[model samples]
Target: MVCRVSGILLAVASAAAVGGCGGEGGPTSPPPPGPPPPPPGPTIGASLNLRPGEVHVLSERDAIRAFEIQGAAEGREYQVIVMSASLSEGRTTPLRVRARADDVSPNVVPNARTNRSGRDAAIPPARGLAGELRPDRDWHLRQMIETERELRRLRARPAEGIGRASRGLAAAVSDVPRVGDTLTVRSAIVPGGGVQCTANTPIKSTVRTVGEHFIIVEDDRLAGRFTEEDYADLDRELDEFIAPVSHEYFGEPDDLDGNQRVIAFFTGEVNRLSEPESGSVVIGFHWIGNLFERENCPASNEAEIVWLIGPDPDAEFGIEIGVDFVKRVARSLVAHEYQHLLNASQRLGGQRGQDTWGNADLWINEGLSHVAEEVTGFYRQGLRVRGNYGYTELIAGDPDLVAFRDFFEGNLENAREYLSATTEFNPLALNNNTLDFATRGWGYVFVRWFGDRYGPAGPGGIVAGSGEAALYRELAVGGPGYLFGYENFLRAAEVVAGETTTWGDVLAEHFAASAADDAHEALPDGAQFSTWNWPRLWEELRTAGVRGLTGGDPLRRRIIQMGAGVSSTDEFDLGSSTARYYHLRAAGGHPSMIVETTIASGGNVPNSAEARIIVVRTR
Candidate 1:
């Protein structure tokens, strides 16, 4: 039977099922197949297009704020993405997302009965692990991030020792301290709470191997043992692959230690800072203070240094670092932390006064470092083979994705967490005083998206700087004033997108892409992610779903799948700088959708709630 509800037509089995947009339009339908494979559906109503950053402000008198999204008037298919983010500079407010049919009939899907919220917002249940993650690990991570932030915030300078060192001390060519030689290097008197110490940390260290770019040093008092061959292999990986890759994308490192080579100092103190037994552990680190003059910290080594958790053959420090650990993760550490080393050097080297590297612009720095991790993996796999990134193996259900995942796994894991992270935290809207793992995760996601969009074109696919790296390089060098979050993007964006682009437009599209990642079109000029094949990658992650980070399927991200019926989420608080997503779609019954976003049970939204509703069609 054909019935008309509120002016839209619906094909229903019976007139009794008829209901308004406020009620369940009809009955229930089977859960859709899931993403990575979005089946086509019937064409519904009129084709509607909206300008980017379209704002639909809810008034104090309005009961509910609703927008109508209809299908194409012709043959093209599409979906809808609705994003609600708090514009408040610093606050979290309540938000509710819902969808239902109104002008159309109830019997949308021929066999199925109801409407669907459209995507999955839930994750899989938990799986217990032998080792539980520790809370202090996050504390330690935040500590290190804050320490670097302060150094940059303070606009620190090269140590007095570094600037006034004797000719031989600062020289880059002499081999006064060759391989097998020992030296007493001044190290940090490490402490908690981002504190800087003037004295109290130094260790006797022996050089194991020397590469073109870095010298591998092990503490003489270290417990972890290694062979000459292992040291040689470490030297090769650092000098040949890691060093070259880090240099190419991020620029250069300041030559410290008087040998034209930075020091990869492996020490047990790093281990001492980590969890005693299992959980989130700090394996390695690079202190920004190393670049300053001795007066900055009388004990400043004044050398380009990256510190790693030296090996512990015995479970002496509650964690064991074996030869296998060195072979796998320790090398990867070079790939990760080296970016921090270079970023600080290039940004602060010649000194642009205090305006430059001092800001630390957390998100971009972390994002670029993470990108460095994945890009190096891509380089190792062979220049830039687009689809070659974990596709075939992931789809084939290959258990071991050894090669690429090694470099990119942290990115995928953290991104999953970011999507499932607490609503109170927004990646871009971060606090200078605090930091989190998932926030770091979003940094990776954003940078990856930025590269795919703004990065120069590559050979196989849109690689991160195939010939000459553009925005990524610009971001590292930064502008005259570098603030955290979007401001950094705004400045660098002009380098590629020209002047007129605004933050509202970027935020809207980012939220839109966060939801409707598939249909790159249907969106305005700025809404697109040309690089990654997310669905395929998502499908691969269905199994080894992160236990603690994402208890359910990480793919669930922000998708709220309301079947062929009316659907709504429990009122959730929307935090500043954070975005909340709701996806809606009609059933087989070719009907128009009415998506309502409002305060669940309120008189009206607050005036200070600088709210912007960005809707995009993702067919």
Candidate 2:
């Protein structure tokens, strides 16, 4: 809100003579020795003019009085006068007088400073006393009240709109399948080099596209209902799934134990589902329900993939797969789910325990999984891709992100809301919350910093492996060790862009210099400062300036840093005080020698003490 103020006025009052008392016993014996010369009248000054309902304070020295102008309006001008009198007891009495619109003419007395003071002076308008004044109703105040009401109404509707939109979208897409269908086949290939299926068998599988490689499954069950469009959509999705991971390492072959365990695990499941040992997982493409619903399944030791039949896969995961070659849709689904399997295996060592599933490490798990989907060429919406990257980068960048990530991963504060029936296994929980915003933003910054500091090594010298643990370690160890270590990534970014000087250095110098002026002289010794303690001081350093200084003699200089300059002398007289001074110098500039004085009082004896030395960079 912006505020505008008009000019103010100050009015002074003149002394009035007291007439002699009439019919009062010959003037009460000559006014009791002249009544000590009939002490002087009070000097009157104008009250502070202000808008109606506006709070104002009148302060003379330390004594203050607060009042609101009840009759004035915003953008309107009025005159107010203050009359003050001092009593023999050294106390002051005050009175306020005001003039509203049309109460005084604009051309009144042609800017006369005062009316004639003699007995023959013209009589001025009968200005009412303070007791007679009344507050006027201001139209501007009414307008402001109405404006606030309208704004509140306007703000309320958008919130409702957002809630409605969320509900509508959820309702519309709630039934779409979270996982693609899985199919079991009795043979490796048909006479036409396509998948052949046998009855009463099922294999766990998911759909994915990997480059140009295509897998096709054709079964008699799907012959009448499947259309050409369905096949094409499946192929397209397959292509999208394989794009990002085609050249990227989902995990090192060594680390994944040559992928044998992963392949063996899936193959064993396929063998059970298919008759006569087909030796392969055949995917059957279909829709089940929302991603969360699939994740909510209570079955322990159940196969990770399930098959369902439906008209559209695009309705889920926001991917579009044109219809055609229904067999490839099955293959794509297998590939996509396989990637997840591979990722999960690498992260969890191929463990199939229920505890290993949905570990709530969504920032890393989902972020990396989404990245896997992207790298594999899945044609998901750009927003989803960006969102994943944004979150990944955020985690990579800051220690605070780690804290927030841990909080969300643990489902601490908003755990119930996040794990509610309506939203289970939902990555959107993090994205929609304030915690995600801070983490992601900070993570991106940290990743950029890691790139700058380590160069091509790109965080832990491993490009594709999960870098979370390494990044967390680096932040924990490196941040407090150096200035702006938390913001090191941003500093590196600035330096790369030619901003010169790391943010750490700048902050340290500023804080070191500003410490003197704003130092807490009365604070307990050995008190520690944390992030929460420095905001105002930082603002002052940024907006104002900081001064650095050194105290003590040459043998041992006591570094005294100040944001504003500190007085040199420590001595203070009952009548006057002098500031203790220290030598000043700029950061990275020459050091100059100077002298400072110290004065001690109170005549108290000191005792033996012990001290712990701690070194901290101010920036």
Candidate 3:
């Protein structure tokens, strides 16, 4: 008898099936209701109408596509030149493509780079500086990148463990470190001038607040001067927010020393590493050696550890870490380094991408760290800049706003820099450790933009796992759904925006959204950030120059001045993961302009430096 049957006599019910698939012969229980029949797929013939510069991706491969290049007016002028391009790694065979005039057009206007335009104009780093990290700003990333390579290179030798303390070996991994336990750590000279993360420098740590997720350790002597609550605040932020946020988005950390928690070694030693007059501030950093087995890598503690500069008001060392973390600088670095730890840990545990270090691509990794900082900012105190305010009022008052500005300014400011010179920076270049503000900010913008679309985007681009855990987890651990690196990015984007999304689509639209103007308005649809009006915010920040960081400018003023259809064109070298923008408008009285696109060459557009234009018409 099925349980669904109305009340039955106890005797019969006992003899028959009670509930789901009961034992003994019984009326065949219906196979557990199969999953609701798959949703009906979309109807067949899909049509897309693109405007003068609007883009539509041809879904089918090696299949012909149709375009009716219609013009309502006789003088409707538009440049429609399509050249075959590939974001793929290899060269393309000579394929059939039809574009007008094989050579540069006489009417074509020579477009210089945004940075190259003027002095007030933002200058891009020279071509040689293409993929380099910012000078002295990121010692941690530089050190770790080389450290991983050196360790792997050294791994070819047989039986290479730094050895155990039980055997009286050097820098051995100890048993689970407990509160109040002091441990000797093998560290390195701060990477200002000398060798980086060499493990020769030694620092003593006294375990302070050992939380469930983080073991807060302080430098033995001076660091203990900070109140226990001060130390515990670091642990609390990591436990309640930072660590969990990182673990959610980038996966968990490694427990190489059987601690099952991250050792956040806060010391003044790190802060003092900064050379005087250089103005470089070294924040928290998780040494990559901690991930390696001590037996394999001599410098390794074989445990997860992030070293941070501690509070020193006098600047006896260099930069002050500041005591009140919840109110100041240290809080941000906690989230920053924590993300690095999780990302590296995730890749170390079988999710490695194309980088030589077997970690996630640097742009992706750095971007996440930057986003991690801002998201933590939102989570910690909530974003203070909710709407566009006049530059004068915003700077003049609001203490909470000022604290928020100081804390949440780096990524925001860097992204503004990225916007000023979007054409030069390649968001996907992984060839070297050229991890500057532009590249790093590009990643941050990508993640923020993607999360705004796919993830549970809340106010100001904060993607919270509270609503949906899937996107966060999928991002952290590369799966069959999203392999890794650039491939991972493309597929995951398809999951939200539809599978028709491609590198070209991403480049074109991203260029539009980030341009901070009606350029996005002129593009297809859904090109700008779903939340956050960047143009207004940047405009406010720029008008108030007081918000600018010491070395960096607040934001560059937009240099280009545009007018109605003057009939002009420009050539571009569209490299892999880079894009450029063009404006095509109808003549002063004409109704509209139509652009037809196609590729005509044995073209390898990835590095082809070929000419392509994406028109952003002014309304």
Candidate 4:
């Protein structure tokens, strides 16, 4: 029964399956499986995040996504591994990767799997990302971290390890940054106690304040700024200019070291006088342009004098006005002003006198100063007079010495006459007729005459010893005062000579002596005559001249003849006849005298002496 039932079931199941298949089609296949799903797309295997000085692992999703973009559908499989990564300040770090893949068909192998390593290696590390944190994605992260840490330590210990590194960096960049050719420094005086200077680099140093006290360094852009080398050169030149003059006038180098000494001396003198010191005197030893300018006087000393000196052309003394003459002139100027100071202090009588311009007796003051210049040798030798009063005017017209004198005396008869005079006296008038000769001519002549008459044992005997003080005393009280008061100095001199045998007699004797000496030198040895031995020869000649009416004897006639002889033969006469004869007679001695003349052979008076022989002995 079980077998019959199994057979019947099998037969029915088959019939049912056949009938169902026959209902659909003649050969029905099992329902086709739903279209095979598309092969799985590549997966993102990894991703990375980076930071400064650090490394990071990449996410698997990022890696899969990269593979997906790089791989195609055929056969995609990859194991991506980062080989290295690096980062730097101005550059991006490169990431290296390794990848491998295999598939049934080469065409089916996805390009992403085959080239995953190369594609990963090409990507740069994200900015701010460090290599250390991305070990899996970037193997080189460890190396970068080690290097960066070393750099950090080096920078931290800049004084130690950084020097070498910095030097290396500098050397590497030596071709880039270049140094400049010149550097400058700018300096200025600060109101208080010091000076401020600026240069290319910060510099703070104190300089020596001995010679040039206030000195400051200046920047290159500042005008008049100098460098060390320039300062050295300038200093050298300044030393030269000041050396000679300073040595001559101010003693030695150790005594007067700088301009301060000069200032102190002037100020001390002024203060001693108790006069109201008006203004400050600025002594600018370095300034060269103009020595003085009234308009630019400092407010502290409105009436002050500014003495400026320029660089020395010779480079001997680093001072201005080093020339000997210049220093002498300067000294004289100072002395002159000092004298005025003294007069003011003493309340001298002459100081109160006024001239035509309502000024004090400038002539006397200036004349005295002019004389002082000679005595002190402040000016060139022989510069006794102020010469050029009408020189400028003389250029246009012949100089009228008389007119010049009138102008100088300020004694013009008329305004027109005054106008016609040389302008030297009126320096303010720059007219065409103005001349400088008046100052030169009158100044010198008057001073010379004064010196000749009154100086050093002249008749009045006013010697120049302690400047004008002694001179003034002698002039005020000595023979000069009496003679000047009586208007008889010249007359007195003449009378003194006349009473002692006359100036003419003395001069004659001098000429005769000089002639005799010359003739003696030229003659044979035995021909010379001694005044004592030939007393009669000289005595006979004294009375042989034309007799005079006033004199008892013909001594006056002899004197006249002697005077004539001097005038005729002065050129050949070496010594002054008047001087020689006075000395001889004062010493109780006489000079041998002689006369010689050449007459034409045809002259009349045969057998007569051709030349008259005259001799005089007045012992």
Index of the highest-lDDT prediction: 1
lDDT of 4 by residue, 219-290 (tens): 222223223454454234223332222222212211111122111011111111111232211122111001
Provide the TM-score for each candidate, comma-separated.
0.76, 0.24, 0.68, 0.21
If candidate 2 were superposed on the true structure by all CA atoms, what would the RMSD be?
27.2
Q: What digit string (tens of lDDT, one per residue) describes model 3 on residues 1-619? A: 0011122233322233355545677555544543553432112112222453354433232111212222233333232223223454322322222111212232232332223222233433322111111224545556666766766766621121224332211233355566777778766554554334345567777888778888877787565458877777667877887766566556676555666677777777776666656645555577666666545556656567777767676666665434653235556766877777776565565533323234446667777787777666555554332222233333344555643453356676567556555445554444444555666667777776665555533332233332223454555555553356766666665653355565566555555555433234554444556435665555555555433432233233222212323222233333445543333334433422222222232222223533233333323
Tens digits of per-residue lDDT for model 2 on 1-619?
A: 1122233454545455555766845553332322333332112111233222222212231111111222221122211111111111122111111111222222221221211111112212111111121111121122223322432333311111112223211232221212232333222122221222111133333322112433333333333344556555655654444423422434321111111111111122121222222222222311111111111211111122223222222422122222331232333334434444433333333232223223232233223332332223212322212121322332343444332222122121111121111101122223222232222222222232232232222222223323322332222222222212224333333433334554333322221222321133332212212111222433432343211101111111123322122222212210000001122222432221111111122221111101011112211
List candidate 2 stretches off by more than 4 Å. 1-220, 224-247, 252-339, 350-358, 376-619
Ranking by lDDT: 1, 3, 2, 4
| Local distance difference test, candidate 3 | 0.50
- Taken over the whole model, the C-alpha lDDT of each candidate is 0.56, 0.25, 0.50, 0.22
Q: After superposition, how far is residue 386 of candidate 2 from its true place, in Å?
A: 12
Candidate of highest TM-score? 1
| Model 3 ranges off by over 4 Å | 1-135, 156-178, 190-198, 313-327, 351-360, 382-398, 428-433, 456-469, 480-482, 494-500, 516-525, 543-546, 549-573, 582-612, 616-618
The residue ranges of model 4 lying beyond 4 angstroms of the native Cα positions read 1-329, 332-363, 378-437, 454-619
Error of 1 at 261 (Å): 1.8
Residue 569, candidate 4: how far off, in angstroms?
28
